[model samples]
Target chain A: MWQYEKKLQYPVKIANPNPKLAQLIITQYGGPDGELGASLRYLSQRYSMPYAEVKGLLTDIGTEELAHLEMICAMVHQLTRNLSEEEIKGTPFANYFVDHTTGVYPVAASSVPWRAEYIASKGDIITDLHEDLAAEQKARTTYDNLIRMVDDPDVLDPLRFLRQRELNHYQRFGEALRLTSDRLNEKNFYSFNPSFDKHCNK
Target chain B: MAMKERIYAYDFAIVEMNLYLDTHPEDKDALCLFHQYQEKREQLIEAYEAQFGPYISNVNDVQGDKFTWICDPWPWEYSKEV
Candidate 1:
């Protein structure tokens, strides 16, 4: 059961409205390596995780990803708020404007709608953890790309914070992988699917 | 700082401590901090809800529910107001 917390995990206050930047940052909100996908993937995978530590990691990180999702939405909201009609028609966001009209929508920078196919839930602990680790790196890289593109300190501050969080989550996921591996057979970690096979006897 | 700001601070500390405790569950000091702030958070929530409005549902006995949990002037809205 989750309780409502009315505060963002990290504050996002963008003073200037730049439609071009909004078009780019919207990617994090619903792009291929978006936080929405990350949150759903880990939360779904946790149900089948074999060990307590890994499950806890997935739950915690997945919850954090939800927080990230909120921050990204906040960014998009503040960025696109109160745009003039001319600004909308002059910028690339004119296309998005026609559809969303200053509303927050989850679509990639390329204008692709968010899809469940962006994430994988294999139900295997090893497979899921590896996927999670890779996901973190991908997210970090996306943030890096965003950081390079934007010069506004307002946007950059939160982007840096989010990037750091991805690194921290990567470290925690690595620990989860180690904890899971330690319990498996020393001879062959791949001998069985600990989540499904009752014979492993961890 | 305003009461809302104080509550936000407490909640932020609790969140950071929570993430730490998840990975280091056996760490006694982190556990202690988490419990301490959790209680502080609950107390602040109670006090704030009594004085200002309900930030959390049913943490304190709020009067005459019109389903104010979905009320306007949300926390994010308050930040902008500040």
Candidate 2:
């Protein structure tokens, strides 16, 4: 069971409200390589994971991704707060404002709504772990792109922290892959699907 | 506010260490560090809750006649003074 903590995993206090920047950052909230997909992918994949360590890592990382999702929402909320009518007239955020009206909605920078197809949860352990590793790298790249375009220290601080987290998750997933392989047949790790082939040697 | 930030730092360290220990379960040094952070985190949370109401909803930190759980300035909301 999950309990609510009335605090963010990290602090997001942005003094300046930049609707333009918020438009870009909202992508992380619902983009293809977003936190929502990352969390759902890992959490869903855990049921099929054969190793206890991988299962625990998936649960922990998935929970952390939820926190990251909250952080992304907070950033978007702060960046769009108290926008004047004139501020919304010609900005890129005007289109979004027409729909959400200062509310944070999950959508890519291109305005595409979030979709489950953005993530994969194949029942295969090796495939899933590789997918997770790639997912982390993709998320890290998105953060890097955001960091490149953002100059505000308030925003940059959290983005950098989040980026670092992606790297950490990637490293852990790699270790998980190694651990999984270590427990498998050294001759041909792919000879059988550990998650499905129940009769295979444990 | 500084106290809250410190608590966040400690909590983050604990979380990072926890993920590490999940895969490297046999690392005694990492487990020790995780426990140390956990202890410090508990102390900081106690102090923080005493001054700033409960950080989680289940805590019994109410004083007079108010339910502080529904207090303003949720995690997402920004305050200039903060």
Candidate 3:
């Protein structure tokens, strides 16, 4: 069961509206390595995770990513809100405005719409944990890129918070991998895929 | 910060502490802090809903001529200039 919390993980208060920056930031909103993907990836992968701790980790981290997604959307919304038609005319946001008209649409800075194909929920425990580790690194790199591009302090604050969270998630997922690996046969780590080959593991 | 904003801050602290406690169940200090924040959060929510509207959906018994539970200025709209 999920409970709704009325606050964002980190507050996004951008006093200045920069559509150009918003275009880049939107990538993390719906892009391949974005929070939305991160949330969906862990949540979908949890069902097949072999251990209770790992499954619980996936649920907690996935829920946090959902909050992160909301924070990113809030940043994008504040940055693009109330844009003058003239301000939008000669900006990269022109294309986005044409389609969304200041509304928050889930698409990358490259304008690629979010797709389910970006994530995987391989039923194998080890494979999914490895993927989770990689996904966290990818998200951190994306945040690094966004931090380098934006000069606004307001925007940078929340982005830094999110970047720190990616590092935290990476650590958690790494620990989960270790925990799962420890449960497997020490002589042959890959003796069996615990998720699918349950009979041999027990 | 406003009263509502303070309540949000406390709620966020509780949520963060809860996640930490989830993975580190043996951490006594962190567990203590989580309880502290939880208490603060409950107090803030109670005060806010008393003065304003329902912050939590489960406790929405305070009725009025207008359904303050379903009013404007949602959480997203709070602190935002939109």
TM-score of each: 0.87, 0.94, 0.88
Candidate 2 CAPRI grade:
medium
lDDT of 2 by residue, A25-67 (tens): 9989999999889889999999999889999999999999999
lDDT of 2 by residue, B1-82 (tens): 5886778788899999989998999999999999999999889879987897765535454768987678777889997533
Report iRMS values in order.
Answer: 3.2, 2.0, 3.6
Top-scoring candidate (TM-score): 2
lDDT of each: 0.82, 0.90, 0.82
Off by over 4 Å in 3: A199-202, B1-6, B47-63, B78-82
Worst 10 residues of 3 chain B by lDDT: B73-82
Docking quality level of the chain pair in candidate 1: acceptable
> Tens-digit lDDT track for model 3 on A1-202?
7876545666778888899998999998789999899999999999997788888889988988998989889888888877789999989899999999988888998999999988999898888988889999999999999998988998999999999988888888887887777777765567677888766452
**Winner on DockQ (1 vs 3):** 1
How high is the TM-score of chain B in model 1?
0.70
Q: What share of the true interface contacts does each candidate keep?
A: 0.20, 0.80, 0.15
Collision pairs in model 2: none
* lDDT of model 1 at position A200: 65
Specify the highest-lDDT model's number: 2
Tens-digit lDDT string for candidate 3 (B1-82):
7876686677667766766665676799998898888888789878887887666444243455655455554444425531
Stretches of candidate 1 off by over 4 Å are B43-70, B75-82
Q: How accurately is candidate 1 docked according to DockQ?
A: 0.33
Q: Each candidate's DockQ score against the native complex?
A: 0.33, 0.69, 0.32
RMSD of 2: 1.8
Residue by residue across A84-191, what tens digits does model 1's lDDT show? Answer: 898888789999988988888889999998999999998788888889999999999999999999999989998999999899889888888787777877665776
lDDT of 1 at A130: 88
